[model samples]
Target: MATANADAAEVERLYELGDRLSSAKDKSQHAADYEAIIASVKGQNVKAKQLAAQLIPRYFRSFPALGTFAMEAMFDLVEMEELAIRIQAIRGFPLLGKDAEFISKIADILGQLLTSGTAFLLSFLSSNVKCGYASQVLSCISEENVERDAVHKALMSLIRQDVKNSLQPLFKHVESGSEIREKIICFLRDKVFPVKAELLKPQAEMERYITDLIKKSVQDVTGLEFKLFMDFLRSLSIFGDTAPRESFQELIEIIQAQADLDAQFDVSDIDHIERWTSCIYMALPIFTVWPIQLNNN
Candidate 1:
């Protein structure tokens, strides 16, 4: 019972400290208070940790000098066992790295998160963060001043390195009504696909890559999966002038097969038929016109 009382007292104390930091007039005193809160985070106090997670971003925004320390703390929080703490850490990202000067640093940190902290970070962002917010963070990293090409290359390399395994979590989120669907599609369309189209050659190796990506996106028959597959096709169409004729033909065949399967369903399944038909209709024009477009180009 005494332990429970102590925990309650600690939570209240943390909240009081948060209030004090918010209203503190002296800049030095505010920094000192923020540092104290950061220290309290190390103790076995859940409330302190939560409050610290919430305040770090604010402190980083208010005091640029504290950003390096705040970011270090945020990265540590990313690995925390508690979901709430991790979520708050992810939330702090936008504020912590909002300045133009911090974009490259943010990109490097994000690359690390992608490489080493893939599962939980991706899961949390996909399920928890709002749709456009993810795109915003990505856009910051891809800004002109930052190493856009390098970051894009690293991201595509990660994707191509394990197209199936790396994207499975993202695909699962799309299937489960997560906002990550829009974020992933936007990132691919805006950052990766455009650059990749220029670099990709009409070679056997490139064909295999395209084939693998399409096959992975089409592996499931869920409605959301179908939508994601269509989005992939749409992204490819943006490179119509550069895309190989044979690759487009293969994609057409895959869509046709899906359409045929949809036709096999009973008339009562009008919704399924309509969905499949729409995808086929949307994709057909791009696939059919690509060869002509390439010739014109």
Candidate 2:
């Protein structure tokens, strides 16, 4: 048996050998070298295991017949005690994505990490949603008991991708009366309103995305949802700026669609409670809270 402690020279020798095998026309002639490399992946040496994890994926396209062994070896590395080695295996996942069926299998394994956990194991988020990897992101965030920091981090990343890319997948799954929808909207509200409300801070690039997110979230909302969220939107100085006015204009249309009364509003007739409440709901966000100064503005 070869010594498990693979030296630097041996690692270089194996790497150079694989470089030849990568371009070789008749790889079957070098079957012994391939087998030896695979064996080194299971060797008790850290460097050899990481080397195999990297090499297998790098030359994945070159050797079609050994894919199963390569994938299993990668998965084994994913579970290894060493973080660097696990990262090497994880980085190889996309290389193996050509097989959609196999990609789903990989997603399932990772979904467990992203969505589920306990103190006894490596405690990261886990996923229960069955969807393509793109949609899986939203599923993880939408899930109950998932940490707030994770959701916020994911939202930031998704918004960075494109605001629409973040919301479409999320709202696609969020139905009427869904806790998921409610939480998403509420989180968006809390994330922006507290900071924006306090300071007339100059618009940062991220604020633009957050503004777009706020605008998109209030769409198709009405009744209690529209009253609460759009009112918060109306109060933002962020929207008062020239740069974001167009975004706010579109959002105003969304507000009017949901909050505008069907019949002409009778302001003096505070006689009817339902009508008066509707009037108040519409007026509160538009008019500053100063009751006496409302007519001046």
What does candidate 2's lDDT look like per residue over 1-297, in tens digits?
Answer: 346334666688678778778888887677666766766778667887788877776666555677777778877886787655765666666566554435545533433333221221222223322334546454434432343344344344333334333344443322333434655555555653455532323445444554555556554554566666656655555544443435444554554544444546776655434534664567554334322222211
What is candidate 2's local distance difference test score? 0.53
Candidate 1 structure quality by residue, lDDT tens digits, 1-297: 997788788778767777887787765557777776677667776666877888877766666777677777877776677656755665565565555455445444444443333344456567646755777455433432233333345445444444433334444433444444444544555665555544345434553565455565454455555665655554654334566677566666666655555346776888767866766675667656674222211
Instruction: Point to the candidate with the largest TM-score.
Output: 1
With a 3 Å backbone cut-off (N, CA, C), the pairs that clash in candidate 1 are none
Which predicted model would earn the best lDDT? Answer: 1
